[model samples]
Target: MKALHIITGLGVGGAEQQLRLLLAHLPVDCDVVTLTNPGAVADGLIDDGVRVVHLGMTGNRDLAALPRLVKLIRAGGYDLVHTHLYRACVYGRIAARLAGVKAVVATEHSLGDSQMEGRRLSTGVRALYLASERLGRATVAVSPTVADRLQRWGVPGPRIEIVPNGIDVARFRFDPLLRERTRRRLGLPEGAYVVGGVGRLTAGKRFDVLIRALAELPREYWLLLVGGGAEESVLRRAAHDAGVTDRVLFTGERPGGGLPGADLPSLTAAMDVLCSPCAEEAFGLAVVEAMAAGLPVLYVSCPAVEDLPPSAARGARRVQGGADSFVRALLRVRAEGAGPRSVPDAAHHYCITRSAAQLMDVYTAAVSCTSLGVSSS
Candidate 1:
């Protein structure tokens, strides 16, 4: 089937990267549209031979793009229009309906109990989301927790489909030589215990908590902060206040642009342990990548890993509370000398191939149900 995928912007975030991976595996003709700032991921998508259109939306109030997007959908003759991220889900669903597309699906990649699209929680926000969600055939949740959150936000249970986020597992396997090379490249001292955290340096990511926790750990334990956002300066200051600035290394944003850059897997391999302190994570993509790299993970609470079977999360520790809780967990892990633990089976469970197959099923089922005049909701 012909499909058109829409997203807010083709930045290097998890949702954007996930979209690129999903398109590679989807068994259908597809094109992509970015509403604004066609960033680095846009280049990667173009390299992969995917058609990407930048709508040049001025801001959230740019309603003129609606007709233009609808025209593109109609001209492309796409049978299905699947959207990712918030702005795309809202506008894409409306445009799909206006364009007379029968199958419309939206993947909720970052929704949480306290936030949506990095905005504060409010009834008006939920009302807007619920209104747009009703126009779609199905809302795909990246995890069961996200599905439950949607339900709590007033989306019907039947309308929410749980499709956990997937990763290219083999791409992230541990490589001792590569790890050593990466450590050397990053100027990390040999034999220093490395504690790593991935994702945007946003307030929601709570990277400050990780820095604080790092202060509580011994000097030999270093902190690696990956990804980038507006909170970098603040986090750096937090590390300074905690007197761990020298131990903290910020890699900024690495988009994995098929160049000689420090990619996620290599950076992941360089870490002795992966720490995710984000309390409201919809799906822990970094945590899964770390697992694929055979690194023990200490997550404050990630529904993505928590929902997995025990065997898949064999080396992961789910600690609760706040920074103090994380500090205690990190101390315990360091004391035990938590080494790389193999979890090859986790790749099977969170593989992109499986996610692609499941999504294809959702697309086919939604279209078939529409053809049969049955309500997807």
Candidate 2:
């Protein structure tokens, strides 16, 4: 089946990474095209022989991309259009209908009582979303919290399906030899306890809070943050102001580089624990990666994180969702062991492969429902 997936950007983020997996793993003949600009994740798509149309949409919902987006959808003859992120979801659904695509679906990767940014904007978007949601075939909630959020926004009835983000557990499984080699190559002391995180240095991510919490911890614990964004300067300043700048490192945006997960997984395996202190998280990709690496995670409780089993509760000493708890949890994990344990498989039924398959089902269902003139029930 031909598929067209839309997202705000192909930048280094959880949803983008998930899209990368989808493009890579889908059936060889299945056509795929992206709505956002080609990014660090594009090389993989090209390698997989998938078509990527960089709308030059930039991240701001460019109207220019809309015409191209409409033309592309019409020309590609996509059977289904699956969208991620808010702008893309709205734009994709509208464009799909305008192009007369067979089916349209959107996934809610974030959940909230209020959005992280402008309330007025969220209100306006919610209104448009309500309209398209009624017109679209299916809606996917990355977590139960997202479902509630969509329902609160009056999403075309209660048909939203919960599809938690998943990882290729086998890919992230523990590798002691790789970790030792990575540490040696990076010149890190063999016994140093490295607390790491992989995410953009954004206000919502609360990397500053992590720095604040790290200042309270003992000196042996070093923090390594992967991924970068517009606020790297602000976050670095926050760390410097907190007097913990020396303890943290930023790898900046990789655009099209590789070393671990983005830099290659060795850095992941080298981490004793991955601390995701985001005040808000939709699916907590960084946390799950840590868990997959057998590295424990310390994060404040967030709705999307509800799907994750606390490492502490599973005998890994989880924090109580605060700065102090964060420090205590960090020390607790160190004293306990380096193994954070992988997420229980049952937690995420929506593996990338399975998620794509479900979209196919949703696609077929959308066709049938549309043909029957029945709305989502």
Candidate 3:
């Protein structure tokens, strides 16, 4: 079936990269449209021969783009319109309906109990999201935790589909030579124990907590902050203030140039341990990537990892007391020494093939209902 995927600015975030990866695995003919800046992922999509349209939305309230989006959907004659991120979900669903498209699906990639779009959760914001969500046939949650959160936010249980985020397991498999090369390229000391965190450098990610945790660790322990955001300068200053600037490394916005410049597997190979201190994570993609790389993971709160089966949860440890807890976890893992661990079978469950298959099921269900003149919701 012909499908059009819509997303808020195509920057190099998890959701944007996930869309890029999903397109390669999905069986249907799909095109992409970005509401604003078509950034890095747009370039990657173009390289992959996917048609990407930029609406040039002035801002969040740019209502004029609605008609333009509707025209595009109608002209494309798409059987399904799949939306991602918040703004796209709201506007895409509306435009799909306006264009008379019967099947519309949205993926909820980053919503949690404490925050939505890295901002404080307010009643009005929740109301706006729920209202937009109702316009779609189904909402795909990246994790079961996200599905539970959607229900708590008033989305009907049946409308929420749990589809865990996937990673390239083989790409992240541990390789001693590659790890050494990656560390050398990144200017990391051979003997130092590395603690790495990946994702946008936003306040919600609590990189500050990670910096503080690093400060408390031994001098041989180093911090590698991957991914970039507006919080870069603030985090740099915090690192300097903590007197760990020498030990802390910032790889800027783009660390590795492979795969739209994310190069997650290479960067993950360089890390001795992975940390995700964000409490409001909808699904911990980086954490899973680390596990796939055979590195131990220390997380403050991540339901995605927590929900894994015991056999698959092998190198992951959850710590509670914030920075102090992080410090202890780091030291404990260091004491245990780095050794080869098998990539969990559960990790394989999140491969892109599985994600694509689950997504196709959602798409087929939505289209089947639409064809039958029955409400999917």
Candidate 4:
């Protein structure tokens, strides 16, 4: 099948990485197209032999690009147009219909959990999300939480499909020697316990919360922050205010250019624990990566990760981080024999190959439904 995978920006993050993985590994019988800001993530797909289309819009609401999008889709004769994120879904769906594409699919990597904060824009997005759901041949969310979130927001239940974000563990596997070499290259201490968090430097990621939690931890523990965005300066100051500046490492905007982008896995293998203190996460991709690396995951009560460990089992350690509760969780995880008794099997759950197969099922199901003139229901 000829597939056109559209996203907002080709930056470094869970969704973008997931897209690269899917594009790189899907059967060669399938063709791929990516639409986004000209970024390293887009560059990565191109490197993998996947065709990418760069709109290079001067601003977010660049309507002029729509015609070109329609023209491209029509010319390419794509059987399916799979869009990611809000912008792509809304615009790509309309474009696909205009181009006479048969199936329009969308993947919800993250929903706008910050709706209250982005209230001014949320009203419009909610409407658009609902419309896109109706237009899409199938709607996919990377987790049950995300799919349900869409249902609560007005997307019909029949339209929602839960497909968790996946990783390529073979590509993301832990490598102690490589980890040491990476630390040395990055000028980090070889023996220090590095707690790593990789994501967009934005409000939802809650990097400030992670830094504050660090203040309550031992001085020897280092915090590694990756990626870049509007929240960079704020986080830098937050790190300083937490009195953990020396221990904080920020690697701004290094996107893995193609399939199995390289930043996190190497950095993760060097870490003692993978920490995600975000206020809300759609699928918690970082948590899965850490889990796949056999590292214990710590989060601020994310249902996706928190529920994995039974009332008493080897799962994530939940902490009400950035407050008294967070400090306690930090201390507990740091305590001898308090964290994961053994490293987890994080790889089994999130492998991209398996994820792709699962997505292919969703794709096949949706395409078959469309071919039969039926609904995803």
Candidate 5:
């Protein structure tokens, strides 16, 4: 079936990258539209021969863009309209209805307990989201954790589908040569313990806790932070204040653009451990990816692993508290020594192929239900 995927922007965040991976595996003709900045992920989509259109949406209240989107959707004659992210969900749903496309679906990729896409869940935001969500046939939550959040936010239980985010598992397999080369490229000593943190460097992510924790570690212990955001300077200042600036390495927004040491898997190969300090997380995708690379992970919260049994991701440990607690955990892990562990079952469970197949079922159900003229109830 012909489907058009709409998202707020095409930045290098988890949601954007997840959409790219999903499109590669879904068995359908699809095009993409980005409402604003067509950044790295947009380029990757184009490189993969996917049609990507920038809607030139100025901001959230860009009502003019709505009619334009409706016109585009109507002209495309798409059978389904799938949206990702918040702005796209709101506008894409209304535009699909105006464009006469009945089969509409959305994926809630980054819905945390109290925040979504790093934005606080204000009363108005909840009301607006619920209003637009009603226009869609189904809303896919990235995890059962997020499905619960959506239901709490007033989305009907039957209308919410749980399609956990997936990853290319084999691509992240631990490689000895890659590990050596990537560590050398990053100027890390062969035996140095690298504490890796991958995610958008936002205040909500609490990357600063890692910086503070780094100060308590030995000089040979290094901190590798992947991804970029508004909090880079804040994190840099924190690193400086902690007197561990020299040991902290920040790779600014690597989108796996074929860079040898910069790509995520290569960086994961070089890491000794992955640490996610964020107390609130939707799915903890990075943690899963790291586990796929056979790296041990420490996190404050990760629904993707927590929702499953302990054996699903044996290498991942959930640590409570802040920098002090992280420092203690780091010390314990250091004493145990760093080595590649067995890739946990959790990594295999979230394989991109499986997610693609599950999403196709969601698409099929939405389309068939819409054809019957049944309310998306």
Candidate 6:
């Protein structure tokens, strides 16, 4: 079926990258529209031969974008309109209905209990979300935790589908040669016990906790932070204050470049272990991807692993209590030494093919329901 995906931005965040990966596996003709910031992922989509349009939306109240979106959707004659991220969902749903497209779907990629997309939820935000959410045939939650959060926000249980964020497992497989080359490229010393953290450098992600934890460890235990955000300077300052600035390495927004250490998989290969100190996570995609690389993961919270049985991800451990807690966990991990890299069952479970197949079912169901003139509610 012909589908159009709308998102607020095409930056190098998890949602944007997830969309790029999903499109490669989904068995349907699809195009993408970014309201603003058609950055790295947009280029990747273009490289993959996907049509991407930038709406040039200036701000949240860019009312002009609504009509342009409606015109695009109506002219494209798409069978389904799928929205991602918050702003896109609100505007996409309204535009889809105006464009005469009833089979709409939205994926709640970054919803937390108290925050969404790193922004605190207000009364008006919740009201607007629920109002627009009613226009869609289904709202996909990236995890059961997010599904529960959607239901609590007044989305009907039946209307919310749990489609976990997926990864290309083979792309993340650990490689010894890659590990050596990536470490050399990053100027990491031999036998360095790297403590890797992958995600946006945001305060909500609590990457500062990793910086603080880095100070307590030995000098050989290097800290490698992947991804970029508004908090980079703040995190750099935190590292400076913690006196681990020299040992802390930041790779600013690597979005699958051609070089060996340029992409996420190769970067993961260079790491000894991965730590995510963020207390709230929708799916903990970084943790799963690290596990796919056969790296043990220490996370403050990860619904993707927590929702499953303990045996699903044996290398993943949940730690609490801030920097001190992380420091303790890292010390324990260092004591145990780096083990053989083995992809966990959790990584295999969230394979991109499985997520694409499940999403196709959602698309088929939405179209079937629409043909019957039945309400998504």
Q: Estimate each model's TM-score.
A: 0.96, 0.87, 0.97, 0.90, 0.98, 0.98
Minimal lDDT window, size 10, model 1: 253-262
Candidate 1 segments exceeding 4 Å error: 256-262, 338-340, 375-377
Tens digit per residue, CA lDDT, model 4, 197-295: 777898877778778778887777788887788899999998888888899999887664224456666777677777777777776777766766667
Candidate 1 local lDDT, 1-377, one digit each (tens): 89999999987788988898888888899999999989988888888899999998999889999999999999999989999998899999999999999699999999988887689888887788889998889999999989988888889998888887888776786788988999999999878889999988889888898888888887888999989889999999999999999999999988851222338888988898999988889989888888888888888768877787777677888888777888888788778875655765765688888999999989998888778887645
Model 4 stretches with alpha carbons more than 4 Å out: 28-36, 116-121, 256-261, 301-303, 306-315, 321-323, 337-346, 375-377
Could you give the C-alpha RMSD of every candidate to the true structure, in order shown?
A: 1.8, 3.2, 1.5, 2.9, 1.5, 1.5
* Count of backbone collisions in candidate 6: 0
| Angstrom error at residue 280, model 6 | 1.2
Tell how far residue 122 is off in model 3, in angstroms: 1.4
The order by descending TM-score is 6, 5, 3, 1, 4, 2
- Which residue segments of model 2 deviate by more than 4 Å? 28-36, 58-61, 116-121, 254-264, 302-305, 308-318, 339-351, 371-373
lDDT of 5 by residue, 196-248 (tens): 99999999999999999899888888999999999999999999988999999
The clash numbers for all candidates, in the given order, read: 0, 8, 0, 7, 0, 0
Pairing residues by index, what is the TM-score of model 6? 0.98
TM-score of candidate 4 against the unseen true structure = 0.90
Error of 2 at 335 (Å): 2.1
338: Cα error in model 3, Å: 0.9
lDDT of each: 0.86, 0.67, 0.87, 0.71, 0.92, 0.92
lDDT, model 1, position 317: 87
Q: Which of the two, 2 or 6, has more TM-score? A: 6
lDDT of 6 by residue, 1-377 (tens): 99999999998888998998899889899999999999988988998899999999999999999999999999999999999999999999999999999999999999898899988988999999999999999999999999999999899999999999888888888889988998999999877889999988888999998888888888889999999999999999998898899999999998742212238988999999999888889999899999999999999899999999999998899997999999999999878977889888999999988999999999999999999999876
| Cα error, candidate 6, residue 171 (Å) | 0.8
Between candidates 3 and 4, the one scoring higher on lDDT is: 3
Q: List the residue pairs that clash in candidate 6.
A: none
TM-score for candidate 2, residues paired by index? 0.87
Residue 76 CA error for candidate 4 (Å)? 0.4
